[model samples]
Target chain A: MIEAHSISFRYHEAWVLQEVSFRVEKGEFVGVIGPNGSGKTTLLKLLYGLLAPQRGEILFELVPMKKMDRRDIAKRIAVVAQETQLLFPFSVLETVLMGRSPYLGRLLFESEKDLEIARKAMEWTKILPFSERPVEELSGGERKRVFIARALAQEPEVILLDEPTANLDIEHQIDFLDLILTLNRERGLTIVMASHDMNIASEFCDRLILLQEGRIYQMGTPEEVVTKENIESVYGCEVWIDQHPVSGMPRISLLRKGGR
Target chain B: MKIITLKKVLTISILLGFVLIVIILISITMGSVKVPPLRSIRILFRAILGLKGAGNETERTIILSLRLPRAILAGFVGAGLSVSGATFQALLRNPLADPYILGVSSGAAVGAIIAILLGLGVSSFGLPLVSFLGALLSIVVVFYCGRQEGRIHPHTLLLAGVIVGSFLSALIMFFISLSQKEELRTIIFWLMGDFSFSNARSILIIFPYILLGVFLLYLRARHLNLILSGEESAVQLGVDVERLKLVSYLSASLITAASVSVCGLIGFVGLIIPHSVRLIFGPDHRLLIPASALIGASFLVACDTFARTLLAPVELPVGVVTAAFGGPFFIYLLRTRKAIRTL
Candidate 1:
């Protein structure tokens, strides 16, 4: 489990995240939902220790993240950020093997055991067939899977994802969420995902944290947070909310002003 | 994605090592005076093994004293520059990065030109020392200028390097314009990269710097591979990204300084050899670094050979030969190879 206490982060004079505090419990899928520039991505980065909070602290299993070595932090928490530009044409296998880097020494190459773990991760992500292909040649969805496999290869207790399905088609988006859901259920991997899609988050996430302008607007079950009143107040938009017929979760639909 | 095992790396190294040795032998045999390959190899082994024999004195002298040292110096310089190039490319995550991209070569050139103008003997260590100090100074200034919020930003570093390099190059041009006829020729020859003046002592001086730099880089090869993914990801993967950048930058600059001090600016070996190696081998720095060193050594030795022998009595600068040969060949590879297009 991870805990944040009054953590704030600023990029110059503007605070990207202000007085934000939350907890991610073990084996839970927590979706962080917000509009553009709501500090979702910044919060995920702060959670993984990529950027330190300007005030307060983050703790992993009751230990302050500041006290943990980067390698130690990496071993417990993995992140699949938005697709990074691939500078080198590293093969799929090579890219996946990089996840084992936290466990490796400066001079050490991946051992047979590390390779085995990576292989299993690739298999779990259903990307084993293209293991020899360079990552640059993969489609966006396939590359996302490759990154998930890479994060899985870390064998972390928690995985942080930043708008992972933003570029995918609906089919691939559902497929990606399903993969993550399976990991949370089967492997007991705690997930803290940042997403813009409200319906998808409602159906998949155990709980939702709604952020508005660098502060948590609401944090509760999807039914409690994804109401029509909350959406209009925070997003300043007209919206209709209803239950998803299949899963019976809260569903949101945008409404034009004076139209619907 | 075949696993890069120790055995595979060693096998490739040995194969390239053989190629390097064969190229060195061929280079030694070639010159205005042609020594046969067999006799050159014999003279080389005898000299290396410290064995005395009734060999032809002129042939022995040419192979042992002049051509041999020049070829070895070329090999070291080639290896150093290419390895530095590969390291810089990885650190910056830009395929266009080469060893001289950081302004180290220009700084060294300015130092060497100043030493030449001051009448410092080429044979003395003072010239090389001053050149290395200049290179070191440029590195410090560039790094200082490139820092953002206590971290070195790649774009800022690159921009700083260009600015510093341009400033130093202007200084070099100013010095060149002010020099007299004899000093001008020496300055021009040095700028064009001459290996004719190389002796055993010069080779000895640069050998350790190049070796240490390359060895330190090789040790960081795995970390470099992780870095190619991106700095943020590298940090998440537990790499000390800042430390890696600092170490690689300094090591690559150290070798570049050592090489430019002894042989002046050799140009394309650093830029082309790493690309060629990456095209043949994969982008994995573990193999890329050593393979580039070997191929670069052979390429430079061969280029230096052509510089000395192509016109017979009239010698061309090794830089001219490298650029002329390397440019066309790299273009050919770029045109024909699909993999190279990705870079």
Candidate 2:
């Protein structure tokens, strides 16, 4: 579980996150939904210890994040950001093996145990077939899967993903989300994912945290949080909300200005 | 499944080591007077084993006094520059980065030129010391200039290096304008890169620096691999990115300074050799660094040998030979590779 108290982050004299506080319970699938510039990515980075909150502290498992060593934090938290521009050629396997870096000692190569873990991670992500191919040669969806495999190779207890399906096609979006959902359901992996797609978030997350202009607008189950008024107020857009006939979860349909 | 296994890479490295030994023997035997490769090998072996009468007195004298030290010095310089090149390229996350590209060499050159202007003897350890300071200063300047918000940008770093390099070159010219004809000739020859003045002491002076630098860089190969993935990703993977950058920059600059002090700025070896090794062996620094060092040593020894022998009595600067040979080889590489990948 992770707890952030009164967290605020400023970039270039502008506060991207202000007085934001939240808690994520162990093994919970949480989705952070926000419009553009709503500090979703910044919050995830702060939680992962990549950025320190200006006025708040983040705690992981009752310990202040500041007290934890980087390697220690890395062992427990894995992050996948929007696709990184790899200027160098690394094979898919190499990229995934980097996930084990926190576990290896200095001057040590990948031991049999490390390789085995990486192999299992690759298998979980279904990226084992292209393990020898250069990451640069992979499609965007495949590369995203590669990154997920890398995060899984860390064997971290918590996974933080920033827009993991941003550029993915519909099929790959469903595929990628299914993979994350399977990890959360079967492996009990805690996931804190930032996403712009409300339907996907509503469908997958056990709970939703809606962010508006650097503050949490609402936090609850999708039915409680994804109400029509809440969506319009946070996003400044009108929306219609109804229950999914299949899963009984809240579904949102936007009201475009032409129709409105 | 691994495309390039550790075992295969190790075997190739060992094979290259043998090839390097053979090249060293061939290089020592080559000059205005040709000594056979077998005779050269015997002389070297006997000398190493402390046995006598492997060759006549003249052959022994040539092998020991003229060729051996020079060959060793060339080997060190080549290996040092090449490994340093690999380090800079990885640290900067740009394939185009090398010591010369980063202006570290030019900075050291300024120090050497200043020492020569002050009439410091070429053999004096002061030359190497000053050069080391100069190289360190240049990297500091470039590093500072390139950094924005605690991160180094590849574009800014490359631009800063070019700017610093040109500034130092101008300073060198200003001093050249103030020098007498004899000093000018010496400075020009040094700038073009020469090993004619190499001796046993120079070899000893440069060896440890290269060895230490290469070993440290090789040890950080995994860190370098992570770094090339991008700083944020590297940090996420638990690497202390800033510390890795600082250590690699220092080690690389130290070796560049040592090599530059002993033999003036040799261009292209640093740029060409490592990139070539990367193309063949992939960008895994564990293999890339050592392979670059071995291949660089062989390449420079051969180039220096040709420099000494091609015109018979008139020796060309080895830098010229490298630029001539390396430039073409690099172009060929660019044309041949389907795509350039960063690892």
Candidate 3:
């Protein structure tokens, strides 16, 4: 559970986030969607306490974010960033084991239980076989899965991801979403993700937060907020919105705007 | 540090062991005086088993007086440089990172150069003391310039390191130009790296700082591993990324400064040794860091031995010997291992 109140952020003269506020309920899967430079990442950073708001405060489970140590915050939340460029060539297992660092004591090595947790996390993420291979050698999809395993290793109640599916292939994308959806339902983890793929967010998210120029433009069920008129108004585009035949979720298609 | 099942414990141990033996033998056999190979071996065996021996008083003199301390100094220098290089590479997460890349070497160089200019070498250990002071000042200066919002931005730190290092090097060169020609020769040899005067005093002088640095780094081995995942992820993993960074820069620079003050400039042991260890063993800092220390000490001991004996009576500077081998060997590695997968 987390909340942001009237957060405003500016970089130099440019405003990145303006008076943004939102609450993520426990066990909620909230998908944040917007075009590039819509302040999605800035909001995420603010929520994670990586940045302090220029205007307002972020509360993590009712505590002022600034009051908690970064390590203490890590025990409750895990983040999987878009890219992991480690110049030190670590093996996949080594990467996953790092997830246990938050819970480890100073000077204490990873214990049997810690290693077991890492192993289980790797198994669930299906990267157990590549345990000893360097992370840099991983395919994009495999590396993504490895990072997901690392987050899972944290055993956090809330997992925040910045574009878990951006570079994935369609097949891997389906696989990734299914895995995340499984984690949400079975583990009851809170999932907050920012994605550019509106269709995936519409299909997978329980609720969607649509952002436009650093402010919350719309927030509702996919069917309630993904109307063609709402989308065109926010995204400046025309689209065909229809139901997915199998999942019965709203699936959108772009119909070129102001056709020549 | 979790010892992964795939951890090659035996291989690392074997490599360390093999290097130790070679280094010991090399150090004893070669020095300013060319004792017969057999006599050197005899002296080595006696020293190891604590056996008493006779007439080799001069040989005994060479063993205790000249070779042993120099060998120890060489090992310490190697270990320090290698570990420093490994730490820098991890902190920067750049393959090109080395101990000197942060300007610690140039800072120390400038410090030592100023000592020479001020004629501080007249004191038995004044040069090392002044050089250490110089190094500390450079780190303080670099620290001030590198800080932003209570943290060092990696890019800004790297760039500032280069700028500061070059500036200090320029100052060192300026002083070298103004020095009397006789002092210049001595300064030049010292800059090229030598262990000719290494003794218990020099070792004892810098030991606390070097060991302190090594200790500080050792405690954060796991944190450094996480840092390579990028600072943001490192923070998410519970490392005090900002605080730890300052510690990293300060501790690393302290060791670099101290070691350089006492031993002068050694080349490439830092870059080549760490990368080589990484290539053989994966980049787990737990393994890589200790491995860097052990292997680095042995590597430098061997090189220092080679430098002393390669031309006999007139010894080559250890820096020249190390650089000669390290530079060409590095290029060879690049050519042969160019396509070696990093992922």
Give all candidates' CA lDDT scores: 0.90, 0.87, 0.82
Candidate achieving higher TM-score, 1 or 2: 1
Give DockQ per model, in order. 0.70, 0.61, 0.56
Candidate 1: tens digits of C-alpha lDDT, residues A1-260: 89999999998999999899889899999999999999999999889888899898999999999888889988989999897768877889999999998998664578899999999999999999999888999999999999999999999999999998898998999889999999999989999999999988999999999999999999999999999999999999888898999999999998888894
Query: Which has the higher TM-score value, candidate number 2 or candidate number 3?
Result: 2
Worst 10 residues of 3 chain A by lDDT: A105-114
Judged by whole-model lDDT over C-alpha atoms, candidate 1 comes out at 0.90
Q: List the residue pairs that clash in candidate 3.
A: A136-B343, A137-B343
TM-score of candidate 1 against the unseen true structure: 0.97
Ten residues in a row with the worst lDDT in model 1 chain A?
Answer: A101-110
The positional error of residue A122 in candidate 1, measured at the CA in angstroms, is 1.0
Provide the lDDT at A240 for model 2.
86
Model 3 residue B303 lDDT score? 84
Name the top DockQ candidate.
Answer: 1
By TM-score, the candidates rank as 1, 2, 3
Off by over 4 Å in 3: B1-18, B36-57, B331-343
Compute the lDDT of residue A149 as modeled in candidate 2: 95
lDDT of 2 at B21: 81
